[model samples]
Target: MAVVEGLLLQATSTGLLLGALVLLLVYYLSSSFSFKEEDNEPPGPKPLPLLGNLLQLDLKQPHESLCELAKTYGSVFKVYFGPKKVVVLAGYKTVKQALVNHAEEFGEREIGKLFKNLSEEHGILFSNGENWREMRRFALTNLRDFGMGKRGSEEKIVEEIQYIVEEFGKFEGKAFDTTQPVNNAVSNIISSIVYGSRFEYSDPQFKEMVNRANENVRIGGSAPIRLYNVFPWIGPFLKSKRKLERNTEKNRKEINGIISSLQETLHPDDRRGFIDSFLVRKQSDEKSGQKNSRFNDKNLLSTVLNLFVAGTDTTGTTLRWGLLLMAKNPHIQDRVHEEIDRVIGGRQVVVEDRKNLPYTDAVIHEIQRCANIVPMSLPHVTSCDVHFNGFFIKKGTTVYPLLTSVLRDESEWESPQTFNPDHFLDKQGRFAKKDAFMPFSAGRRVCLGESLARMELFLFFTSLLQHFRFTPPPGVSKDQLDLTPVSGITLNPSPHKLCAVKRS
Candidate 1:
């Protein structure tokens, strides 16, 4: 008993000494590293040592919390995530000026430890400098050629929309979860682009891959991920962080499998898909003795993963929001149907129909505005020391361009808090363009698949609405439906069912 007590006392003393050392370290760092109010730093709530305003912010729905902060701090201010201080640019004007007027200064994407873990420090999404420049240029050129944001893309989308329309018909007017089918259909568009093929709806591999991808996105916004980004060495002990690491690895493996198959059958003369084009470019680079080329196998695989994941989730989740919102607001849905009937009755609705169906276009824009799927965009970094709005942001400071602020800025929208299609409509009911309509985001690093997503959203949304009237499940009133989103890096709807009643 005496021996045990002695051992316990020694261990307790050691723990106490270690804790004191940590406290001393924290105190030193907080005083030395923290920005002072007189430093011309963006004004914000006073941050606590080590915690750094973490308690003041919501981990789950940070944008909502950040919106509240903007009320107190104004459009441009500093907010710390952990010990890291991030300058948040809110409202349309502020964001536009920073991302547009000062593009070069805010062009670099901040690669947090978790993001590095996901991308393996390769890929366009997280890379910087010459690598990012080369990858972005290569990707944009090839994607445009393949049909992204072009007339050729519309044909691909229309083809895919037909399958989804048929799939909706299968429900035969009964309530069902449209999540899987919608995700599968939307993801397949990306699949067709990247891998040159789409998967069967019931394909187990396809379903698992998507589920894992979504999980990674969910994880990206989890507290564990935030912690991992701050303290990467602690990641091994966090299950969520571990799971995210595994998901990225698994995603890379799956993409590599597809790339390997494509490589074997890749014809030098004919570019079947993005992968083929990349392979052809890689070979050309090798032949030209461009030894330090970025078109290697690792880059190709990482980029494919990047495109597939980014393309699938943002657009898929937005489509889901569109259907749910329509169900909740039948009058708006009726108006949409009326416009479709008046504009493209007895014929397939195409992207061009958007110009004619003004109300429908307005509804789509309103849906995106309300959905605000990606509330806080991926963190950006200051490429150089920037002096803006009387604030001195150091070079390489992590910055967050909060989209939620712009999407729902009171100054910009007539009914920012309410779901009103009139937000996108003029007095004449013509579809009006809003500088604040940045669902695909804006400026240099705007979503790469913006054109593809727009085509998909219009075609799929119109086609589905044409074939079926979405509604709350039987016995569930529309008022009872929840529009509250599951907060993460992106906002997603909670799991719920809606009826897809066949239209006459």
Candidate 2:
């Protein structure tokens, strides 16, 4: 009896100790979650140790997840990206407030490892301080002077649109992939501006450059970039990804070689292309004995490459989506065609044509909004220690515009999920621009190629619709419209081909 009683006492004591431990753990967890409720930082979902809210983030569609989190939190919320924390700005109000109102404070580029190798001293996209100011000013002025953001540029686009129309004829009304041909047209436009020349679609070197550009654009933020971020030292372990890196290096060399050859051939009297204009600037600076003139072959080459990269794929992808959408919605396509015919008649449509074609103009704007490319604008860093929406965003902290959230924010749009051009149009049918319509972004770092992109979108879209009615091949329904994007550095439609059937 005595032994049994002792054993019972030991068991009861063990049970009590175990229960206390469990209770302590529960208290710790609950306290941890509730501890920061009184703080001034923006409300956020609970984070796990080391990882924080990383596991909760959806890698595939981070914007969607962040949007959901925004409801529980607010327009501006902080979320952890691994050990790193990124403050996401959602909706027009928050995004505009940060990007436009406080533009300078948030103007720092994230400077990813990949871009560091490529554009360390290149131009405006990555450079800081005097370099950024100088290059940005020079590029902007030069582009504007060369007719980038004005009616003067319309002639160049009109010419390219004509070429695109000619190529569509080669399809003979048969089904084909419009990606390459569309890209070629855009490349020609940029090439005309930068190199003062355009390449034939048949040029092997041009084709190779196009391929490299496509590959680079397609691989951004892929598993490889993430892997590099996680295990940067393991570059040799990931051989395939290393190959992509090598290919990118090869592309840089080729671009440099081309620029070098062009420089040798450029005559002192003749200044054509952006590079030539830059050389002229350099020579003038030398004559003036200006020290450390930023206008050099390196800067010129980087700027040219940047133009091709940012302009080509982005415009091409949007057009790809636009045509796909038009095919799926023939009524909308017809209305656009009708507008083009009614407004411009048989004359070549110019940048000025937009004022007369409100419906078409609205449709173009809608396409840009709906596409929502660059979900996060190539990561931006805070320029200095600053406060945003009550959060203590430290200096050098990386921030994302969370553009996808803004574009598709239910709070801002009538039908956030649907493809509605009416969002950009008033009840009276005039084109109404939205402050939220920031496909090219806003403020200090707004797209350098905004004018060129808009011109291309209008010209190519109208020109194509004027020439042909795009549709799926017979037996394929609009339901089969591969709306599934090939999501990479750029949002692109799948490999589905379409029939650009020539209109009567």
Candidate 3:
């Protein structure tokens, strides 16, 4: 009987231990889940399993959809693109705070699958941490050295403007799509800075390169490409993805050819342009036996590619928008024309003349604000876990600084929805600066070529206005001109023709 009692006691002890362990596990898990609930994560639309908020977003105009969501869920909110969670900072105040105030926390570039496949995080645009820092520094320094924003650059642009004027004269006031010529002209400016020389517009190779680059930009933001970003495995099935890959490969080969020619003729003392400067640095790094230098051939190729594409697309698109806007609002165009004719007369419009042309300057600023080309800016990732605006965002969460919201912020602009130059003009009618004018974006990841772009826009716009009057084709009223932008990596004007009538 005693032996039987002992066995029962042992069994009882084992059962109690097992029960205690189960209770402890339950408490720990419950506490963990409760802790997450108390984290005060940003509010967002309810996400479906696996799909997340894919159905909620408009793939074509995701920025527009997010702006609408901001109406219901405040400035700081979360949304899911598939299983990926993203925190969006909307409005001028919120965006500025997150980007400028909390820059480090919200500064890292979020490399989507498409970008990852294209860039492999090698270049300045899609890279992070040490590699990005080194490349950006080098690019900025080299670009400035090659007269990116200086008088040298001004001279290059002035020369290019004459070419553009000559090209427009070829149209002889006939209605023609300005896309190719405008893209070519703007591209040559960067080409001059990158390759140290401009290509003739008639050059087949040059035209092909420019056309391919622009096409990539157009297709990069297509619905299929957006889906590819969310579901990378579907890339092989998507035509857009395959086309992008093909275009990228061809461009890579062409770029390699150009770089090889530049490499063979590289003169250390007479570094011609950005490519020469990079090659010289690469050679120096090699001679020093530097291990893992960021100046490798891959970095050089990717960086050049990044600079070429970025330098061409945004400035070119903005210039196109300016012309289209001028065509759409002839009154605004007239004022701009009057300003240019009044301030600088028939003489060349130089960078130094910007201050004297406040009305014209205001118009340009307003163009950028209204154009809102890079509506989403580039996606940013959190460098670390962040508690921002009463919300907890974990480390590595993708963040979209909604530039569209800031550019169109109701609180910031007096007429946010309209094209109003007075938005940048004070009661005194002088050119005034608004803190919310962030067409190039803000903070650490702000555009590297901002100064260069500013110079380009002013010179290009003023010069074009001086030479020709932009108008919609015959029988197309100003009202009939559509402002609807074609979806792209940059918002582009839809297929339209305008007459660049030579000013009498």
Which candidate gets the maximum lDDT versus the true structure? 3
Candidate 2 local lDDT, 194-275, one digit each (tens)? 7777888888888778777877877655544543453344344444456567766777787787677777898867756676
Question: What lDDT does each candidate get?
Answer: 0.83, 0.76, 0.86
TM-score of each: 0.92, 0.88, 0.92
All candidates in order of TM-score, best leading: 1, 3, 2
Alpha-carbon runs more than 4 Å astray in model 1: 1-38
* Candidate 1 lDDT, 1-504, residue by residue in tens: 344323323333233223333543655664656644436788889887665777787667778889999999998898876578889999999998989999999989999887776566688888888888889898999888888878877877888888888888888888888888898899998888777788888888889899888888887887556655764544444567667778878888887888888889999788888999999999999999997889998889888888988888989999999999999999999999998888888788778888998888888888899999988888899999999887888888888899999999999999899889998888998989998998877778898888888888888988888888999998999999899898767788888899888888
Worst 10 residues of 3 by lDDT: 8-17
Instruction: Return model 2's CA RMSD, one decimal.
Output: 10.3
Candidate 2: stretches off by over 4 Å: 1-39, 285-291
What's the CA error at residue 401 for candidate 1, in Å? Answer: 0.8
Weakest lDDT window of 10 consecutive positions for candidate 1:
8-17
TM-score: the better of candidates 2 and 3: 3
